[model samples]
Each structure stands twice: as C-alpha cells, then as structure tokens.
Target: MTLEQLKIGQRCKVKKVLAQGMLKRKLLEMGITPGAEILFRKVAPLGDPIQISLRGYELSIRKVDAKNISVEIID
Candidate 1:
C-alpha cells in the first residue's frame, strides 16, 4: 500500500519511493529510504499534512508527497 493509506498509529516499512528529482533527493536526505520504519503519528485537521515518526524524529509531509512513498504495514 501507499504511505498515505496507512492508518494512524500504524507502523510500516518503506518499500519504495516513487518521487523523482529534487523531491526524491530531499526525501533521501531526510532518511526516508527503502526498509526504513515509519510510524503514523497524526494528520492535520484538514488532512493535508501527515505527521509521522521515523529514525527517532518526527516529520510532517504533505499528502501529495506522502503518495510518492510506498509502504508495507508491519504486523
């Protein structure tokens, strides 16, 4: 499934990142890579930005950007 589809409090591992160019580079710089674990923290009230915990810190990403990430839910 895609990162945007993960439910709140869910844990998943990044499977792949479909973004390209600068966005892709930025995500990589932010430590979002294949096999990285991600936790769905919360979403903005308007549901535009999604908050997640990864690599010991929190990062908020736009829904548009989140869609570029593919993840597999972890049991």
Candidate 2:
C-alpha cells in the first residue's frame, strides 16, 4: 500500500518510491529509501501533511507526496 494509506501509529517499511524528478530526489534526500522503516505519527485534522518517524527523525510530508511512496505494513 501507499504511505498515504497508512493509519496513524502504524509501522511500515519502504518498498518503492514512485515519485519522479525533483520531488523524488528531495524525498530521497529526506532519508526515505527502499527498506527504510517508518512509523506513522500524526496527521492534520484536514489530513494534508502527515508526520512520520524515519531513521530516528520526525519527518512531515504532504499527502500528495506520500502517495508516491509504497510501503508494506510491519506491525
């Protein structure tokens, strides 16, 4: 499933990132990569930007961007 599909507090591992161009590069630079583990942390009431824990850091990403990330539930 996509990262955007993750519910709050769910943990998952990155499978593949489907984004392209600069956005893809930025996501990679933010430490989101294949095999990386992620924990869904929080989301706005409106559900746009979502917070996640990755590589021991908290990262906030847009729901649009999250959609490009494929993940598999871990726990």
Candidate 3:
C-alpha cells in the first residue's frame, strides 16, 4: 500500500519510494528510504500534509508525495 493509505497512528515499513526527479531526491535527503520504518503521526487540518515519524525525526510530507511512497502496514 502507499503511505497515503496508512491510517493515523499506524506504523508501516517503507517498501519503496516511487517518486521521481527532484521529489525523489528530496525525500531521500530527508531520510525516507526503502525499508525505513515510518509511523503515521497525524494529518494536517486540511489533510494535505501528513506528519510522520521516520529516522528518529518527524516529517511533514504532502499527500501527493505520500502517494509515491509504498509501505507495508505494521503494528
């Protein structure tokens, strides 16, 4: 499933990031890589950006970008 599909407070393992061009590079630079563990923290008030904890930090990734990230839901 995609990161955008994960529910809030859910934990998932990043399977792969399907983003391309600068977006992909940006995500990589932010520590979002394949096999990384991600925990969905909360969605923005408007649901555009979703807060997630990854690589020991919290990141606010937009839904559009989240769609490019695939993850396997975990406990």
Candidate 4:
C-alpha cells in the first residue's frame, strides 16, 4: 500500500518512495526513508493535506505526494 492509502491510526513502514529528483530529495530531507516507521494521524476535512507522525515529529503532506510514498501496514 501507499501512504495515501494508510488509514488513520494505522502504523506502517516505508517500503520505498516512487518520486524523482527534487521531490525525492525533499522527502528524504523530511526523514522519509526506507525502514522508517510512520503513524497515520489525520487528514484535512476535504482530505487534501494528511497529518502523519514519524521520526519524532508530525508532518503534513498532500495526498498527491503521499501516493509517491510506498508503505506497508505494520499494525
């Protein structure tokens, strides 16, 4: 599954990121790397920006970008 598909309250591990160039670098800079554990916190009312907890902090990301992040459910 992808980050975009992770349900709220679910925990997942990063499998891979399907982004390229600047986007990939940006994600990496934000600490989204393989083997990273992530918790799906919440999403906007309209589901545009999604809030996730990872690496000791919360990050809000767009669904479009989230789809580029591949993840697998951990719990």
Candidate 5:
C-alpha cells in the first residue's frame, strides 16, 4: 500500500520511495528510507498535508508527496 492510503493510528514500514531527483533526496535526508517504520499521526481538515511520526520525530508531508511513498502495514 502507499503511504497516502494509511489510516490514522496505523503503523507501517516504508517499502520504497517512488519520488525522483530532489524530492527523493530530500525525503531520504529527512530519514524516510526503505525499512523505516512510520506512524500515521494526523491529517489536516482539508486533507492536503499529512502528519507522521518516525525516527523519534514528527514530520508533515503533502498528500501528493506522500503518495510517492510505498508502505506495508505493520498491524
């Protein structure tokens, strides 16, 4: 499944990052890499940006960008 499809409170591991070039690099630099665990935290009312917790930090990502990340549900 894709990161964008995960429900709030779900936990998953990143399988792949489909983004290219700078976008991919930025995500990697921010600690989003294959095998990393991610927790779906919150979403804005409009659902444009998504909040996730990973590596002991919380990060907000745009829905469009979150779609580029592939993940597998943990539980």
Candidate 6:
C-alpha cells in the first residue's frame, strides 16, 4: 500500500518510492528510502499534510508526496 493510504497509528515498513526524476531524488534526500519504518501519527485538519513518525522523529508530508511512497503493513 501507499503511505497516503495508511491510517493513523498504523505502522509499516518502507518498500520503495515510486516517484521519479528530481522528485524521487528529493524524497531520498529527505531520508525516505527503502527499508525504513514509518508510523502514521496524524493527519492535518484539511488532510493535506500527514504527520508520520520516522527515524526517531516526526515529519509531516503532503498527500501527494506520500503517494509516491509504498509500504508493507506491519503487525
């Protein structure tokens, strides 16, 4: 599933990011790479920026950006 589809409190393992070109490179630069663990924290009031826990911290990403990231559900 895609990161944008994860519900609040759900945990997932990063599979890969489908974005290409500069967009994909940018995401990788932000520490979003394969094999990372991610937890959905909360969604913005408007549901645009979704807060997620990653690498021992929280980072908010827009829905569009999250869509580029795919993940495997974790128990």
Across 27-63, the per-residue lDDT of candidate 6 in tens digits comes to: 8877889999999999999868999998898898999
Write model 4 residue lDDT over 1-75, tens digit each, in one string: 899897899999999989999989999899999999999999999968999999999999999999999999996
lDDT of each: 0.95, 0.93, 0.90, 0.94, 0.94, 0.91
User: 1-75 in candidate 3: lDDT tens per residue?
Assistant: 899888889999988989899999998889889989999999999868999999899999889889999899987
Clashing pairs in 2: none
Name model 4 segments beyond 4 Å from true: none
**Poorest 10 consecutive residues by lDDT, candidate 3:** 27-36
TM-score of every model? Answer: 0.97, 0.95, 0.94, 0.96, 0.96, 0.92
Q: Sort by TM-score, best first: what order?
A: 1, 5, 4, 2, 3, 6
Question: How many clashes show up per model?
Answer: 0, 0, 0, 0, 0, 0
Q: What is the C-alpha RMSD of each candidate to the true structure, in Å?
A: 0.6, 0.8, 0.8, 0.7, 0.6, 0.9
Model 2 C-alpha lDDT per residue in residues 1-75, reported as the tens digit of each score: 999899999999999989999999998999999999999999988868999999999999999989999999996
In angstroms, give how far residue 1 of model 1 lies from its true place: 1.1
5 against 6, candidate with superior lDDT = 5
Error of 5 at 74 (Å): 0.1
Task: Please report how far candidate 5 places residue 2 from its true position, in Å.
Answer: 0.7
Clashing pairs for model 4 are: none
Provide the lowest-lDDT 10-residue window in model 6.
23-32
Candidate 1 local lDDT, residue 53: 97
Could you give me the TM-score of model 4 versus the true structure?
Answer: 0.96
Error of 2 at 6 (Å): 0.7
Superior candidate under lDDT, 3 versus 5: 5
Better of 1 and 6 by lDDT: 1
Q: Which stretches in model 3 have alpha-carbon errors above 4 Å?
A: none
Query: 1-75, model 1: which lDDT tens digit per residue?
Result: 889898999999999999999999999899999999999999999977999999999999998999999999999
Residue 18 Cα positional deviation in candidate 6, in Å, after optimal superposition = 0.5
Supply the global lDDT for candidate 3: 0.90
Clashing pairs in 5: none
